[model samples]
Target: MKEGNAISDAHQVTAWPPIRNLVSDMLAISQRTHNGYGLLEFDVTTPLARIAEHKTRMPDGISFTAFLAYCLGHAIGEHPGVHACRQGGRLVVFDDVDISTLLEKTKPDGARVPVIYIVRAANRKSLAEINEEIRRAVRDDLYDDPAVRRRRRIVRMPALLRRGVWWWIRRDPVRRKRQWGTAVLSNVGSAIDARPSWGLVQSFLPCSVTVGGIFERVCWRNERAEPRKMMSVTVAVDHDIVDGVPGGRFVARFAELVEAAAGLDEEFGTSAGDRAEGQSR
Candidate 1:
């Protein structure tokens, strides 16, 4: 079959579901179960301060990205419901953790496009591997490489032309299988700045849970009035999957894990002992 014809058939098989219906159903079930919607924020000043103090010599050099992904996976493993998706008015929870990292590819003319892929059985990947995959996906060279461009061109037509194709392709019964996962991670850390005023949730995706990592800021203690580095994390979740209490609990547990990992002397190969020796100067 021709490529266009194949895409058309796939879209027909994989019809996108309505967001409001799914959200409402989830909310109703959660309410019946006494679950509530929730949002939680954390202040990482102290942990960051501790990391910076030992950075000179102990540079295990783990990037913040790696740490964030590990924390996300750990949290999902602890809170299973946080990784659920709505399927035919029912909640389908995934057993594995597959965090989708969003990437923006810059074309020759400067237009940036987003592409997503599931990192199969992601919980099995180590911190270094996760970090490397993310780096490779975002690299301009990877996006612009001749071979890469050729492959994309052959497989993906312009969105305008592909719409009808996608519609038909999605209609296939088998193609409609749920793309559920434990959670979704959006690393906006590169755009580090003040907390964003707003963000839009993608309407047709299987992401019931989403987390955004914003710019790191300097946090200060109240009484001591000391300055410390910190990063802000924003989580937007489907009200249907989890209620406020459980949501808050999940965030708290996730934060604790991040804090502990951040404080590790051997994280990213940097040792506290090595840093202490250098600080002696």
Candidate 2:
């Protein structure tokens, strides 16, 4: 009731970190781009099963994010136009599918932050390689690099100077791809306790994907309702480069690959008995 009573609520002010500032800058820039958003669901039962099976051999285990990266790379390889960036009057499409993913790390002060790691030539790498790379990035301090350090310095600069750096990067497709990668794939699902249906992500990259947690649902199959694992995936593409048709085709192909569990067997060496058993099933 009194002013003094309202002050009883507890709060503390912490200075915003450089990483947070950088993310804010990226969002501010991405807002200017024409972005098309799509919220879609995929059946991930097959991939989960396969990942569990493969974990018997892989002690560290494979992650669902790695599987998604595998599927996304292949999808982009099939539809490269979806990740093209406009350069003057022409569009620049890179042959390699470099995917930038965020890895959360805790600082010495115990503050958690997300760091970007690019999986170079993701389209050409096997699922196991991708899984190992992600695991290695988490296990070691590789996520902290000179480039990120440079970014930390950039974020500390004045807002106008920081924005100038981003503008310079955005103007050239080659520099942008080399620095930030051709696409972004972030998985926020694994970190949270409760499953989220969907989440929107902003990025300066041409294509960005946000992978959400899985929820069980019933789907009509063989004239009967069957329980299935479903995940919400949000995709945003730069309309300046990616058109509606190509973007739709890319999304459809990505869904098909994910539903089919396209690359599970390629992750590791499977015994003949295991293959035969899988075939029988």
Candidate 3:
């Protein structure tokens, strides 16, 4: 066929059969059940630019997703009570800061698929450790877990059974904490198909943080408009577990950590106790 010429050979068009996955199940739960929300956006202009330079000099470059998750975990660890979940008319606050994050795994055929993995006690891990864990998630076949396999089958059941299972899982505070962690985190900065610098995201969880794309813009600095790199971030919290003051404090601390992200080596050796001490000082 020549350029701009339409050639018809009577090819059949078909749709891919619907298949149930964990993301869809979670997305359904997020959309239908989640009610309370508190949002905060950060002006991460200079910090992101510095991180870009650091990435260039490294052999195994650090991704913004990994950095973002570490900072979130640290902040949550410091204020664990604020990320609590309420169930059975009781508030369950977690002391250990675990995080659920998404990774784009590449298949043998070079196709990419997103998989959810939990970073247990992420607040205790260093920046290097967190980065390695995220990379391992991309390399490993995480969906091979027996429980995940079982859930795949369970999702195919009737709607009534599905709802019942969802309720059973969600209603129990311990089970909910084990499966979904204290918070869910994601970064759409590299999502080429999404809108430039996508800001907020809605999901059903105790806490959620999402990092959007980086853009360059002119903003007032010393009463003059100057160009700078900027990134948008969104944090959402469920009201049942935490009040507005705590949530606001958590967001403020998270923004402070993100702004200091460019100096990552100091962040690497600090344990949870060290972080607490630094914050106190």
Candidate 4:
């Protein structure tokens, strides 16, 4: 492959000690388990309906990103292994919810590079912060900066060369521990317009699981009506973390929460009395 300045430049090297340690730990765990890989899938129609309804009015307020984060946190809280990585026969489960999302931005010339980051304490992050972090990572050129690119190259080097390079980079303990997170979130919805049929996504080794959203077509039947708005949502997940039962339950609960939140306006009364009360308070 003909390498460009973005790929071969030395300045591209930056310290990412945490990511290195995480990879090392994961490798160790995989080596210990008889079957290092696992998979799971479920249908979340109910939850999707609830989420869609809740977001109908406040489209910007209740977003897909926030919903995904909430669901992931809920699932991980119940099943800790969902956020665990294998390290040489031992499974290391993280205490906090650190989610890594992929970001791709167009450059002046139109080329794009995807970068990933650890969104600190994703469970507690507000809708705005989640959106802003994704925006900042994509717009700041942090992914393409010379230093970042160099570090990526070194990390991706052949196994033989990687040992020495990675060792030198890991001298900083803070960097090494900083990168480990409970799980990863991949949004492939940007590629397709419509939601896809519910299914599990296949991904690489190191990553224990992956989730994707697809186009959805939903119709509402009324007494005199035929069809309603064409709407959809995307879903992606790793199978190894949880079994069918728990996965289904998680999806069901998620749907319930979204649905309940959506009906808040109607339940609280959108009538004149409600309006007057609002004015009084």
Tens digit per residue, CA lDDT, model 3, 1-281: 46677776788887542344455666778775454554444667756665666556454556677778788889998888767777767788877777888777777898776666778787887776777677767666877865456566766777678767877888887787776777888877677432345455656677888777666667788999987666666677876666779888888888898877623753443432254344359
Report the C-alpha displacement of residue 181, candidate 2, in angstroms: 0.5
Q: Considering every candidate listed, which one attains the maximal lDDT? A: 2
- What's the alpha carbon RMSD for model 3? 6.3
Q: Report the Cα lDDT for candidate 1.
A: 0.52
lDDT tens per residue, model 2, 179-276: 78999999988865536478888777889899887888889999999989888899999988887888999999999999998778752535423433
Ten residues in a row with the worst lDDT in model 1?
172-181
CA lDDT scores, all candidates in order = 0.52, 0.83, 0.70, 0.47
- Give the runs in model 3 whose Cα sits over 4 Å from its true position: 1-24, 31-40, 192-196, 222-225, 266-281
User: In terms of TM-score, how similar is model 3 to the real structure?
Assistant: 0.79
Error of 2 at 109 (Å): 4.3
Q: Candidate 1 lDDT, tens digit per residue, 1-281?
A: 47654644344465433323333333433333222323444555554554466455443433455556767776766786766665656776666677755567776899675554344455565554554456555663565544335335534454454444433433442232223234566666566455532233442323333334443444555755554434445565556666777777778887887766543444543333444345467
**Between 2 and 4, whose TM-score is larger?**
2
Score residue 232 of candidate 1 by CA lDDT: 49
Q: What's the candidate order when arranged by decreasing TM-score?
A: 2, 3, 1, 4
Q: Ten residues in a row with the worst lDDT in model 4?
A: 227-236
Superposed by TM-score, candidate 4 places the C-alpha of residue 21 at a distance from the truth, in angstroms, of 19
Worst 10 residues of 3 by lDDT: 268-277
lDDT of 4 by residue, 1-281 (tens): 67564565446666655446435643543453332332323234554555456445432333455455555555555555544544446656666667665566576788665555566676565434554455456547675655456656766666657766644444332343354344556655446455442324333222323443343334444545432222133233345544556655655554444434422344322332343345358
TM-score of each: 0.58, 0.89, 0.79, 0.53
